[model samples]
Target: MDRKSVVNQILSLLVSAAILAAGTFVFLTLIRKPEQEASANPKPKPPVVRTVPVLEHDGRLDIVVDGIVTPYREIEVAAEVAGKVVYKNEACNGGRFVTKGTLLIRIDPRDYELQAKRLTSQLEQAGANLNELDVEVKNTEELIKLAKDQLDIERKEVNRLAGLIQERIVTDSAMDKAKQAELTSRNSLVRLQNELQLMKTRKTRLRSAKELVATDLELAELSVARTEITAAVDGVVVQDLAEQDSYVQKGSPLFTLEDTSAVEVKCRLRMEELHWLWRQAGSQRSAQAVAADYQIPQTPVTVTYELTGQDGVRYEWQGVLSRYDGLGLDEVTRTVPCRVVVPDPRAVNLVGADAIARPSGAPPALVRGMFVSIQLHIDQPDPLFLVPEPAVQPGKAVWVVRDGVLALVKPLTLIELIERQTEAGDLESHWLVESKTSALTPGDRVVVPPFGVLSAGMAVEEDGTP
Candidate 1:
């Protein structure tokens, strides 16, 4: 094989010329292909950053509060009178119920009965006196008629005497004597008439002594009635003060009754809670706790109670939203006094359990009387906005890439903060949000890490394409 020539010196030069031409043609063709393609379809400039498609997501919150079950109605029984223990029913406590007019305890009836008997005798005496007055009135009526007749006779004699003396038919002395006698007799008749009238009037009325006795008798009977202690209302007898046949003093204690009317809830909403919660959803009367104002199944009320546990299941009792108790004194704490009725404790507990939490995810149970942190929505939608709250300060800035560059757009404020006593974030800790103007802008070339050179105008390559 000759390196430079082939067949002969002339043949070799010709062969070389042909081979060089062929190589040169192939090389030019390959070079022309890239230039032609480059002009036909130009590759785009890379973007400064990559972005994602945003979709609207729901953003409501569920709020949770700490609370406990409480009774809508409860009472403390106190005695109106004092008495020795005598007839105390064995079953008497907070849980017992009784019927109206039921006898709770009996005091000694001997003394009361004797007093009643004495009153009865006195009442009979009063009746006898009344009868005697009736007889006296009848006799006085007859006497009145007699006195009228005598007065008429005396007037006739005086008239006759006056006429005779004026006509000079009778002596002066005789006329004067007749006049004096008539006047004396007329005066006596008038006195008798007054006496008869007085008797008639007195007969219609009972004597003061008789009236006094009658009142005493009635009182005695009333005292006797009190001896048999009876339940005033339909309730449970919670306290028993006297035993059967026990001696008791007037106005002494005998027994106590508890009105177990119906079940209700007593919720103790703190003063601060009223402003934050829907306490006005139900009225005091419509609320379950108000006994007279509401019915058990039909009515509802705000009730409250205390939670006496730290980490255990707490028991709930009922209470009411009673009137505020501020008597001529300053309050150390400004919490408003609120009462909740515990009409149906089970229902109340269920509602309370749900009403407390405004959680974005699985939340812990709210304990009663404990303070909770909350995030509240303050402002509404606006034309201009900044970065969303949670992603703003912690993460790097995100922007839309354009023409191999970055276009920074306005951001949305995502989270609304309610600064409470137990809130997680502090005002001073939010330095990034405050100094956002100096750090970012509307259009700037940005570099997103983890994805190399995701430049503007770069093809949106199929994800996971190697």
Candidate 2:
């Protein structure tokens, strides 16, 4: 009975197996057509990618920076002499512009004038005294001459008396009297000479006193002149500290003046920017400059002030890269501070295509505390390639398409990344890079974004290429 049951099961299993094989054959036949058709065309189309052509940049590169306007010179006007302010000129007020030597204030000069007059009187008295001494000296000289003549006569008399005494022709008393008269005349001549010497000494002292008085008078007059304060430079008054009837001591602050002759712009630049500047200065550097370590060149810069409420309307002033502002990089910004000096702040040029004619009232001069834009014009000594920032992959590499194949270039030297304004007034960031080992030329196509997975030596087609 088991054998018969097993045989029936085996036959049933065989029939089921045959049915499964038939179904499998039918499935294979239906799928083989599509598989064979796909095998017929084995190579799939290459992926399309967006690419940008590298452009050679002009050697000139303009670096833009924000700056502040400052006065070239700020002068603190102070009182040179102490006095009460008797008059204050209208030009002494704040915001008033005054020319050099323009009198701005007047102090009470009466006191100084009185002092001068007193000195003058003393000087005149001294002169009069000197004249009197001169007259006395002359008179004494004349008297001395007369006394000499008298002495000579006395001597002759004495000689005659002596001879008489010796000859016994005259009494001894007459000879004695003659001797006494001769001695008296000699003493009188000596006295006159002594008086003349004393007069000469007095004259010398009087002359010195006269000179001292004259010097005093000069100083007094100088003080009087100093009482009237005047502008030492052509500038605008920034502050007014002196007023009418205000008493001020010497060295007191009277006003503050900002020289309008020129203005300076204070700006900061990154180290990368400074490198370009150094390159520009390298060729033209003098030995003296090198010795002095004058690193920043006197590069020409354009200072622009955008007029408020006026889009694209800017006032431009030509300036030079005068000096470095500080000794080192700024502590917070890590940038070098520099200064640009505009020799003539008033010489402003309107620099917009739609700029209107200069109005009757002149544009505002570059003053202190004005925020401005400074563009440094620098010329690079070497050629550079500019590529869109996105084209530069990680590790300073770029995906360059050569002969319709993707090639990944690595280790490209990135000189700088700069934001430039397009003609449409849109800002676009570009990478200034140089290829040292790779054959990256000016017209080489660099693959950009919006592409599929990329691999080295993979076939790719430029999206815009036919």
Measured over all alpha carbons after superposition, the RMSD of each candidate to the real structure, in angstroms, is 13.2, 6.5
Clashes of each: 67, 0
lDDT of 2: 0.87
Query: What overall lDDT goes with each candidate model?
Result: 0.47, 0.87
- Which stretches of candidate 2 lie above 4 Å from their native place? 1-39, 127-208, 288-291, 359-363, 410-428, 434-441, 463-466
Which residues of candidate 1, in runs, are more than 4 Å off?
A: 1-86, 93-95, 161-181, 197-208, 237-246, 263-266, 270-272, 276-334, 343-466
Which of the numbered candidates is closest to the native, going by highest lDDT?
2
Query: Best-fitting candidate, measured by TM-score?
Result: 2
lDDT of 2 by residue, 129-211 (tens): 99888888899999999999999999999899888888899999998888899899999999999999998888888899899
Candidate 1 on 1-466: residue-level lDDT in tens? 6855555888878999999999999999999999899899967853323332221222322122333432323344333333444565554444466777776665555666787798789778878977987888777777768777876887788789888888899898887787787777777778777877787677556677677877887876776666556666666565665555565666665556655443322223343344323323333235455443221212123332223332322223333334333322226544433333333333323123433533233222222233222211111121222232332322344444444344443442332232222134433211112122333433322333335543334543322211
Model 2 weakest lDDT span, ten residues long: 286-295
